[model samples]
Target: EWQLALELLQRMPELGATADVISYNAAISACEKAGQWQMAVALLARMPKVGLNPNVISYNAAICACERGLQWESVLDLTRQMSAARVAMNTATHTAALMTFSSAGRWQEALSLGPGGSPRAADLGRSCGTLLMECEQRDLLAVEVSLTDRLSAAAREGRELPADLALVLDLSARLRRREQQPQELQGLFQALRRPRPQGGGRTWASLPYQRELQLLRHVLTEAPAGSAAAAAAAVDDFGAELGEAGSWAKFAGGSKAATLLAAVRGARLGDRVLEIGTYCGNSALRLAAALPGVRVTTLELDPLLVAIARSLLAFAGLAASVDVWTGPSKLLLPRLRPLRFSAIFVDRWGSQYDEDLALIQEHELLQQAGGVLVADNVLTTAAASFLWQVAHPPSNSFEGAFTSRMLAVREVAQSSEEDWMSVSVANFQADVFRQAPPIPPELLALQAASERLRERVIRSEAARLEKGAFTEHAKATLSGAGIAPLE
Candidate 1:
């Protein structure tokens, strides 16, 4: 249908046929939905040539296309032109501009729009949710994650967004990528309105905070003079503490992790953070710095690296907190009884992530309501293995009540050749089982079976070897021949 409209548009222009506003609007809308930002822009530019002055509708369509392209700057420029043309700002236009700036974490620009002393926060949650969906579809999420920052701001402002906002945002973004014939954004939004856990709980609602979350964390601990919002007002104070660092872009986790972490902290209160694989505290520093006053309990099995992290933390003066747990998570998580974290970040040094997550969940560490569990290396293997356990009769070794709320999961943008990196975030809302008694099966029986088989095969091979009297047979044969092959 859209293609037909565009064809009509092209033909009318070539054949000297009269083209009306209806045809132009239909064609422009089609181009916008096609993810054809360039074509949409080009067409809009030619509107004056066709003696049809671009109206608010045309400007809005171009802005929508620019937004999809993540060319928010272009969106801003078009938005200004709309005002210059004396076009009244509608809710959609204001919302689009607000969303663009919010997605970039440019809070100053986002907040400066409305007049009056008291400013109304546009539904930034809608944009946050929308941008996150874009992150998922584009396969390029490692770098852009400012949604959490906006999320925190919305929560603090007491903005009561529709329960189904995330769904609406996701579907709106998807309208470009794929077709959902019977179901459109309306149905999708309705589905998301179903109740769920609130994010940024003292105990997490879902997953890990990236490395640069320290920015938002810092505001939580202490606010500078003349601040309208303090860190305390920034997010739910889930007993989170803050740590600081100097540089994040130079960290081992890459600037993308730092950028996303900072966004999460800035947007929400992220505390009681956990780092599963703290490699010399490079990424740890980024998270510690963004969070205003949240102590991060980082886990690393290697002793040398643990020492290195400690030294780095001390140098950053964050050693007063940011405790380093120097052992396997399986051993440490259980002992820290009565545990509930706002976020659990996993970056285990090796690729045994499947087993490692199983071990962590088996301990029921973040098994409280509104806990977030984020695992790295999932873009390489981001699919949640324990999702089935949470959903049904429970799988081997995993015991939890929750559903995965994926936020962002993908590889770090290309840094150099010969290196690969990725991360996946899953939010979990914990529940208690009222079904048949919780199963007491092995944590990793599926893996255990293979070990047992390997052991059996090794033992059988040894027994077969022992039973063979090769020496005797060789001696007998040599005696019959009165000669030995080697002797």
Candidate 2:
């Protein structure tokens, strides 16, 4: 239908017909209906060049297109143009702008719109609910509670809250009261957290990993400030009081601490927060403390670690504030849609960082504007590939969407050994950043082939081990035969 409408407009030119503002508006609307945001923008831009003046409706159509594409910066830019052209702003204009802010996770800005254009309390509540439902800050929750109170009072007096806002607040209150879980919201949580099949589990941390995390946390806290040498020596002191550091993910080290602090400091109260690697819930605790009543969701790959993290969180009286789920983030992130995060702390295995980020884009998980991505251990060689992707995003895509900064720190337990690390903070900005291009067919085929080969290798090893030939000699024999051993 939209295509036919567009074609009709184009055919008008062949019939010696001139397009008025209505024709352009109709064409733009057609493009919007077809989800052709770029075409809609192009048509709007072409209007003036063709000697037609763009009215408020023209600007609204373009802004709506940008909003559909989640091109928040473009939406804001067109709105500014509308003001410069002296076009009177209307309810539709304000609604479109607010919706853009909401989609991009610019909640603070959304809430700060000027007078004569502010949304109703119920409308504001709906947006706030979207922004703050998963957020931990009490103040934000208090705001919602207050709004709900007002709405309830209004209802008692025969006035009613908007249905959308009422539903959101109801669900939020239920979740807070332990009457519900996010995973229960099938549409929201994406999938159920089922038990993964038991296989030869991979062990990531040894004593060294634990010690490194502990040492890093210790140095960050007790290390003498302003003295590099003292900081170095504190790295050497493994027996220092564990304090708060002892409770965090043992392997996060100092960079993660810095990243968490940076993220929490930059995050507004009640902003939804995500931690990629919970390990033992150390950073999760810190995040909760940093912003009281702030909701924190942490993902761990191992179910065993998930149990441990939950136990620790319970012991710390933080179980209610931090929701720890078991499963790889790549798999779980897709399920966390319609619940965009305000900040994401990446402390997962360094090698998986790139793939994890790709999943984020695939899922549209991050809040588009002012959202932060804080990654730990950016200095490690293993992290180089991930670092490159963020620092040098593909041309015209995610290139200017994030402004990144790298902070230098030391490896956790390997502090005395001078194992340095880095924290990368990438803030989402209101700029044009294209989505990641699709995976090439060749790469997909290669990945499939690799998976098949890996499965074959695992099967052969399982058969060999099942035959009771699990001795060192058998291992050496497999190695000599170029067979991969199971970890």
**Residue 480 local lDDT, model 2:** 37
TM-score, structure 1 vs. true? 0.33
Please provide TM-scores, in order, for all candidate models, with all chains considered together: 0.33, 0.40
RMSD of each: 25.2, 18.7
Candidate no. 2 TM-score: 0.40
User: Which lDDT tens digits does candidate 1 get at residues 271-335?
Assistant: 57777777556556666766758778787653324434553444344554686654445445554
Residue 370 accuracy (lDDT) in model 2: 61
lDDT of 2 at 67: 73
lDDT of each: 0.47, 0.54
Cα lDDT tens digits, model 2, 121-151, are 3243333333232233223655544544444
RMSD of 2: 18.7
Clashing pairs in 2: 135-295, 136-293, 136-294, 136-295, 137-293, 137-294, 212-413, 213-250, 248-282
